[model samples]
Target: MLSGKTLVVAAGIFLLGLVSFGEAIMGGSEAAAHSRPYMASIQAVEGDAMKHECGGFAVADQWLMTAVHCLPAGPNGRKVVLGVHSLSQAEDTKQTFDILELHNHPQFNPDNYDNDIALIKLDRPFNSTEAVKAVAFLRAGGVNPDTNAEVETAGWGSLDNLGNRPDALHEASMGVVSSTRCGRSDYFGRKFTGNMICAHKLCPDPCDGPHRIVDSCDGDSGGPLLYNGVAVGITSNGGKKCGQVKKPGIYTIISHYTEWIDGVMGLQPDA
Candidate 1:
């Protein structure tokens, strides 16, 4: 489970350095309505308002996959927004569900971001539609994608490390980074566990200081890191600053935890 102490410390630094923050699709463009149908917004409801806390994707009729860190510390009215591209708009394509349960990984180590995955069970199942669908998973024994392969992610996180959240859903393209490079001492160091996957942009960004690369920023955590329309990773953590070229965003490797996910979802292991 995510430790409150760890988050408090990280949040303090995030406020001070103006560094790149949480898992938001920092460098991406606006995603079209229902184009990424599997995307879901995890929201914490306070009174009449719903605050977006993290991103997630539907995997079953009533189940969603997200990062454990996104789970609220205390009881709250948790809900999910689905099939909507604009946060403010109540379009016909939009759907909402109350979260009935949260299953955080038993061994999730918030201190080092190990096993930063979780599942959300909805009060009711959603009907399949043009704007709402479950995402595909990487097949059993499927070939692992090579490092530097192009992949996409979508979210409604901050436009920049310290910027306000966008009203529209955003999408960005990034490249997979090898475990060797991601584990470098100068980078994530010992924190980059093998269970995690890292990814970032291959090009440079002048806006993020020096030659920093584009990446997922705050608010994008729990979102899907996709390749060829299949979910391969879940957004987890990132560098000290958002979009630091060398500090690519880290994600929970979905393929590595398929069995556990299947167990939680009551699905066949070979499904």
Candidate 2:
């Protein structure tokens, strides 16, 4: 049931491609991709227990935002792990956190991926002392308003572009692109909208697709789009495949729902 609008959004993303706006996938620098501090160990909907879908932090101790696609259908899904950077030791006793509650857009269209973002309330506030620290959010109107910014994104999802799991976390850096130009791509023309952000390809763009970044793929959805030390967006959807130069990775624009996020999550608006 891909609505025409959803298809248009997908087409928009396919044309724009994943670009690093204002920063890289690992924070602000390319070297920061594999770096800790900004990373989080998310475990969502693993069978009956909390499944370990990939997600990361935005505020220092409050919210853990993610892609709605990570949520398991129905009430059977669960969440685990909270503040940890190393997957090798993420399962260690002290680093894990149980599920609190899950919040996804009520009108999410699975086919169209509208409202693709979600929040995982933590059972307990994140500890001040941990290898994984929450990322910062761009002040209400402080950053990329429409499209195109230098930024970074990171995740520990399955490395293989085609698979749905990953052995550990990996990071990548790239730049953002204009939404207007995004629609001109062979795949995603005029699909860009106010809620979606695009990342263009790099010199050695690995794979080739309108909706994917060769450096990052599946399992990384819901991760952060950090620009200048702020978590400004969340990974949304990729085109049909990974690494098509014609395609780029699209993300949920964090600013679009400012009031809804503050209102629903009960957080103060950014000054």
Candidate 3:
């Protein structure tokens, strides 16, 4: 498939969601530490770097994980800058590392977005911080997360659909939806095989936040999903509009891709 040079949403039974035919991404949470999603920066780019591309998280001391679509290639020498409060420039004290290699799931199908996950291996280990820490990556093992469970999403996308991708990270809260309401039919593949999950507010008219924090939109793809401080999923793709009741937000189930991530990283995803 031709790279659209960009990507990342929604769906309906409830009239709010994470449906694929709609967009299906997920997010991670960190608290006042996570009022919004923060970004990692590249120390210095040769040229055309301002294009800077999509934002990702440091899942490991040396590794930065992001959506496969954001980086079609370039595992070697790729820079993973952490604790960046903004995108303006690189500074000291922010943990930095070099990308020694990259591992994007081999079956990744940009069209259907199957196996939509990637792992970045850093050249060396860096320090961790409360503002920026390693999120727990779970095995999922195809187990359904309990409904009404609180989940959080973090990204650098537009607070609103009509805006630009924020230079810094932003966050929002959602609840895991019951599989029954997601329109499961024999035709939709095995219940959890689609490798996607839905999480949202029980009611979606949407609540206002103090800093005025909003949700995932264009440019928020490949962000993290946090449940009780564990990183469980990544932003896959959601539809165009957001913060509505009818459109359910979809996420690439992280637990479902343990083997692939581990294989690429040369470490066991479950270990």
lDDT of 3 by residue, 1-271 (tens): 5344422211233223223212222232323433332345433365766434455767766676777766666543456667655555554546657777777778777775656788777778766654556666677564446777878776656555445455555667878766555535532234333677766663313442212223356666777777776777777654457544444566678888776666666675444
> Residue 137, candidate 1: how far off, in angstroms?
1.4
**CA shift of 122, model 1, Å:** 0.7
Per-candidate alpha-carbon RMSD to the true structure: 8.8, 10.3, 10.0
**Superior by lDDT: candidate 1 or candidate 3:** 1
Per-model TM-score on C-alpha atoms: 0.85, 0.73, 0.70
Local accuracy of candidate 1 as per-residue lDDT tens digits, 1-271: 7699999998898665444433333456788778999999988876788888899999988999999988836226778989878888778988899888888888899788899989999899998899999998774476556798988888988777556788988888888998899899988889999788898884545233334356887888999999988998899998656776568889888888778888888888662
Task: Give the whole-model CA lDDT for all candidates, comma-separated.
Answer: 0.82, 0.61, 0.59
Least accurate 10 contiguous residues by lDDT in model 2: 20-29
Q: How many backbone clashes does candidate 1 have?
A: 9
lDDT of 1: 0.82
Q: After superposition, which runs of candidate 1 have C-alpha atoms over 4 Å from their true positions?
A: 1-26, 72-75, 204-212
Candidate closest to the true structure, highest lDDT = 1
